[model samples]
Target: MGLLCYGSVGGVMASLILVFSVMWVGGVGGVGFHERGSVMKWSGIPTALSLFAFCYSGHSVYPTIYASMADKTKFSRVLFVSFAVCTINYGVMAVVGYLMFGQATKSQVTLNLPVENMSSKIAIYTTLINPLAKYALIITPLVNAIEEWLQVSKSRFIGILIRTVILISTVIIALTVPYFGYVVALTGSFLSSSATMVLPSLCYLKIFKSSRRWGLELVMILAILVVGVFIAVIGTYVSMKQIVSSL
Candidate 1:
């Protein structure tokens, strides 16, 4: 199920890239699709690169991958290979996309992607091929939460009910929220800072007695936390500006 979900995400990303390429070739341009009042202001390329780095921040699955492996030494080897492939692919795409669309790459890429507009035939086919994929994406975390709360008393029926309620609540909130990016940025700020930076370093420092090595790791972690906080602030401010402008 996890593998299938990963495959679907990869497919979606590939399809979006293809769509971006098409739009670039078709000469579409501009940041018109971004929410109103989004500031284009930035210090320089360094800031632009920092924002671009956020897209690569979803490396949380690395621990799961490492846990699944039988041989621990293979972890570094696997990571190196995987990182190389991802870096090459992302770098090539970014360069090609930038050259093709220049400053409009991000907007063009987001606007041209049309997964929501999938044809009925394709949607039906995907439903048949991966019947549980979409439901699992929405429901799995809810199920886990229910299991945590109910302990051994939780049943499949209970899980399903919990999942349904959560799904409904999410849909309602999504509908009510005027700007999703704002919600995303605010939530992401909290999650990214703690998960990516703060908590990990704390865990390592407390659990591992390797003081010298852990000190360096703590430094790196603090750096990440600082940057994460900065980005989150900027994202939240921009989102608020957008909301105010719309009103």
Candidate 2:
């Protein structure tokens, strides 16, 4: 956000958002698409599914955003719309990007873009400023929760101290981790799966008190919970092994 204070980062981001699809498509065309005629490894399915879980993990922010919405009843509608948009955007990017680069794709797709291409430069520039914009939003909830639990003062000094400490701790951890992408994938696999899929189902099962234990609805939810836990445990182990090997 500091960049927004002194530069046209917001405008640039807006422009990028507006043209991102077009640019992705055009850039894919310009760079050329190739088919490897190869199959994805079965061993990679867990990590791939975990990454998809991360993509759908916007549910974590729903409570905060919903609280700020003017029409509370319309929250479900807003969620549907948001996810629909995201599905389209992510689907297009995934399909086009994969078709364009195939198995050669990197964790950050833009990094796979041709170095000489303007599209690549724009992608790199957008990426540079994205973290600045995302940092506050990502950390604010955790900070607020911690402050509330500790009954910390709402004063600016206390707030700044808390945010700074949290930021520094995360930065330190990130610096220590050699493969940032693997760490993200691991987190998404373990934490995001529970947050996005398991908890919600369990919460619903508990809150509604469904009497039919053998009913299809209950059975499906039970299956989801089991699968979620399985994925979390297995995925974390796999990701940790990969991270260790990288080191």
Candidate 3:
């Protein structure tokens, strides 16, 4: 479980760095230090900062890890080690990606990179690893939903049936929508906000009685909620526009 969790987090961090780097160089304005062609609009530094913050928000996984720990006494030590490892891994990848892409590290960096180049290997790995990781992630939620349904009805057969149905539905959707990234992004943004921000704050408030410091936490939670909403709204709008324009 630890290894899987580490790999999952590490892979995600590497993939995100590549994604943001590609976006930055592709005029997405996140990491582009060069002030070229109206960087004042969506291309500004604020957008870049937001993108970085979003990427670093992977730290939200710590609470889940801590919660699942059998030995709570070693929780802090475990977290420190895990975080250090993840940070080092992420930092190395980000640096390499930045160096490899130089100025053109936009969102689709992998597609633009030469397959013959060594850096392109990272792109390939990112492409392959991300979907597998996403599959694992989606399955967890699906399985939990099935388990809950079964528990509520005390019917193991019903759980199995529901699981089968979900698996079939997923396959059908995957086949119907050749582009699954949009689906993943939509679900990720919504769930990430809830799991990482709102739920954590609530848990802290309830467990620790941090009402005095709750103001700041509440503000941060609200910010995350707003960002999640922004991502969802803008993503939907842009996708719709693209589909319309293409038609």
Q: Which candidate is the best by TM-score?
A: 2
lDDT value for model 3: 0.54
lDDT of 1 by residue, 121-189 (tens): 343343344424344543554466567888834477876677678778977986787654445544555
RMSD of each: 6.8, 3.9, 6.9
Off by over 4 Å in 2: 1-29
Q: Stretches of candidate 1 above 4 Å error?
A: 2-142, 152-154, 174-184, 212-218, 233-235
Which residue segments of model 3 deviate by more than 4 Å?
1-68, 74-108, 118-126, 152-168, 178-185, 188-191, 198-247
| Candidate 1 least-lDDT 10 residues | 29-38
Answer with 1 or 3, whichever has the higher lDDT: 3
Clashing pairs in 3: 21-105, 22-105, 22-106, 22-107, 23-106, 23-107, 25-105, 26-106
**lDDT digits (tens) for residues 1-247 of candidate 2:** 2332234335335434634733554556376555454566788877877777777776645666667666789988977876786677677767666767788877777767766766667766767666666566556667778889888857778889998999899889978766766887798888999997889887887888863467888888888888788768888888888888887
Best by lDDT: 2
Candidate 3 lDDT over 198-217, as tens digits, reads 56656665787565365876
lDDT of candidates 1 onward, in order: 0.53, 0.72, 0.54
- TM-score of every model? 0.59, 0.83, 0.53
Q: Residue 12 of model 2: what lDDT?
A: 36
